[model samples]
Target chain A: MAEILARTVEVTRKYGDVTALDQVSLDIRAGEVVGLLGPNGAGKSTLVNLFAGLRKPTSGRVELLGGSPTDPARRRGIGVTPQETGLPPTLRVGECADFVAAHFPDPVGRGELLDRFGLGDLAKRQIGGLSGGQKRRLAVALAFIGRPRLVFLDEPTTGLDVEARRTLWDGIRRFHAEGGTVVLTSHYLEEIEALAERVVVIGGGRVLTDDTMDAVRGLVGIRRVTLTASGLPELTGVLGVEQEGTRTHLLTADSDALVRELVLSGAPFADLEIRPTSLEEAFLTITGRESQAA
Target chain B: MSLVLTHARYQFLETVRVPIAVIGSAFFPAMAMLFFVVPFAGDNAVASTYATGSMVIFAVMSACLFTYGIGVAEDRAQPWDPYLRTLPAGPVPRFTGRIITVMGLTLIAIIPVLVIAAVLTEATVTVPQLLLGLGAILVGSLPFTLMGLSIGYTFSSKAAIVIAQVVFFPTAVGGGLLTGDPAYAPEFIKIVSPYLPTRGAVELVWAATTDFTPNPLALIMLAVWVVVFAALAVWAYRRDEGRRFT
Candidate 1:
């Protein structure tokens, strides 16, 4: 019910004979972290392009901040990082950051931004001299330069190392905690699991499911509860029961409730392990797009 | 103004980082002056003066066409241009900034030729003519600038390079730039030079710096080229935008 920062009203975008986006509609509200999960060619980038005012829908309307996405005034409050970006190789990192910063009315200071992205040491180095990961860090860093209310990051940590990915995650977390809405797309399920509270599964240019993180995970994966119990009569009637040598395994959608029932029944159990479903398992099941992207 | 200047400054920094780019633009004109003008017409005040103006126009034409045509096409392939285009500010400021940067390079490109003409040749011009020639140089460079933008937006970088080279040499030669004297020009050149934009551009520069009378027909043709290039530039921009983004 919060103010809608951006929305697509049955927007359809086409390129020649192919329809990149169908009559898909979505709304991104203020102060929300939404994850767009999909494989390659799922129209995730196409949809983000519409939100960022980079493209126009062929038929239905695309709106941003209560105006057309193409409007310059509305873009003042939005930030975006595309999937594949090649920074100007000759400009030094600090100079590049400052150049982008100058476009906004109230941009973050160059020095502070450098420090935040761990790019301080590379400040004087030309972008061409930096490693691929360093260049990606700079690209993502530019998105936050304008102190925007909403951000659209398309595969932000694609080429980053684990260490750099963690650092960027920290920055994203800090930004979100400071009341900035984030809309991110990623191939890595862990990335979505780490950041997004709401998940939208997109496949074939359609929204398959849009729900809370827990609910989406519940769809494709059945949580497994393993325990070693002696004389466990109550567990006999449970669904998906597999009896190992001295241990019992129960796979169910509601692991929390099953555990609580066991505890309330005064069953003697040792080493109870409740493992929630992994995002990868859920993604493959819900979208059935395993061969498309990493 | 500040934003445009910032764009210009950054663009300048980006290009100057590659020293060869600066060297390349200045090389041809200086070489033309040294080999063609200084040796043959250095002693003749009238011939050297007109040749000097023609070289200046030559430098301007190369700087605007190759720099914008190839540079814009190459930049279009990069991610930075799209990011900039999607910003809150429109492309006008950036376009103007790029033009200023290219003009700055054009001015620098002409300097070596000018210096060679002054030191080696007897090119004579009054103070008023000198200032007028500078003004004329900038104005005459307009059609070429637009032409560069048109070619750049219309083709890919590799294609742009080929297209620019294909169109450049013949136009320059057919326009009678290297022929020196009108009466001595090839029969084919004399017939076609009045219609080419380069002929009008170099004609204006010659009239500004020497005692040469401006050709009315060439001036009118030059105006027509300006309108044509302007229209092409606009068409290229809209087509590029609609094709890429929409």
Candidate 2:
């Protein structure tokens, strides 16, 4: 069994009258990547901050590495990349890592980190001079500098190009492969779909759903399937049937039985394929939040 | 302590690197003392006293106002506070580091200004008296430094600059540095002035130049100001720490 690295129970945070997080609980295990998904003002950032010990919950307890979250030793084992790129603009990439690394007992070498992030050429350049993508990469590099056992990445790939995002995804996978736990928050559904083994959906300061990607999609249910035939075969139990482009698309929870029926009917169909409902559709159906572009 | 020193060194370098702040706080005051005080070389003992006093206040103001005010804002703009808080040594070291850097920078500015004032105004004071004046000036600046800390933490960057100016000019004027009208100043002003950092600085310089003793009442008042301002700074810092992640 994987070790439980971080856990929170009934966590609630309030800023005066505004509730940022309410009764949120989560468990993250070693060597696993958990995606935290939410719309704007959905308490995603608040949850990440509480886990990182950057913010304290008003009414909950958090444990990091089996110790109090506030302990500096526990914090050293967890790295956080905040939503805002909190880098010193004037400091060079190398200097930024060096400064943060100074706090740790045995940090990874600067050259290794830069090389891993493909920032070798930009090491000597000031952060202000870096492009947005480069700055984002630098923040990610800094997060891993301490060789932390658990990492919290808040929108880690916000400004990256497609290739850079892929590179980061690979790096996260590598980190998890080495038995490091990662909690990631991203607006990109595909990023979560590709990375996270288990996903947690938050909305309005509360958790709407927490399950594996397949389970979440299952909750939304497969899109109803429809098939067309010339003889007008009896299809009484079908969920819904729609005609389009001179053929019928069957809408049903069971695609296999419908396809078997169509094959038995011997319909002159040119195209047929199984289509799974996307996580985005599932997210919209479950949370009822505004539909976001995939 | 070492961690605090590290932060202090960084703060010191950052302050010195800013050209506008360096010129305003250190360079301009030295120039002002040279051009204004040097030309009128005569038996004008009162003008000489005022010049010497004002130069010291100028140094303290530069340290407490420009350095801490701007430095704290810039530090907050980045992840410095969170980063520092994550360190093993905690926030006390960071605060100490800043205080040490401020004190060092104040001394650097004050010494040169004092030398220029002495040469230009032909002010006479022995080495022992000068050392005593330096001690008084260092002690007197604590309240103002704490005041600057409170201002830096309490306001946004733009508001901090405005607040610094608002505090700077009145303190300079009411403390008998610019106007030299302690008598004509209001009774409340006279009573409050001697307790201000500028007032303590001025008293130190005045005593050094004229071989006079400082009033025990002034020292007590300065001490009170230091304690109150220090409390305000701590309160502001704790409140800021709570909201940093927001």
Worst 10 residues of 2 chain B by lDDT: B176-185
Query: Candidate 1, overall lDDT?
Result: 0.84
DockQ of each: 0.40, 0.24
* Candidate that would win on DockQ: 1
Per-residue accuracy of model 2 over A235-292 as CA lDDT, tens digit each:
5445545577566765556678877776787656655656654544445444543233
**Model 2 over residues B138-239: C-alpha lDDT tens digits?**
776787788888888877778888988899887876666654424455776777677666776677666765655666666677678788989998988777
Whole-model lDDT values for every prediction: 0.84, 0.73
| C-alpha RMSD over true interface residues, each candidate | 1.7, 2.8
Question: Chain A: TM-score in each candidate?
Answer: 0.77, 0.77
Where does candidate 1 clash, by residue pair?
none
Candidate 1, CAPRI quality class derived from DockQ = acceptable
- lDDT of residue A44 for candidate 1: 85
Q: List the residue pairs that clash in candidate 2.
A: A224-A251, A224-A252, A225-A250, A225-A251, A225-A252, A226-A249, A226-A250, A226-A251
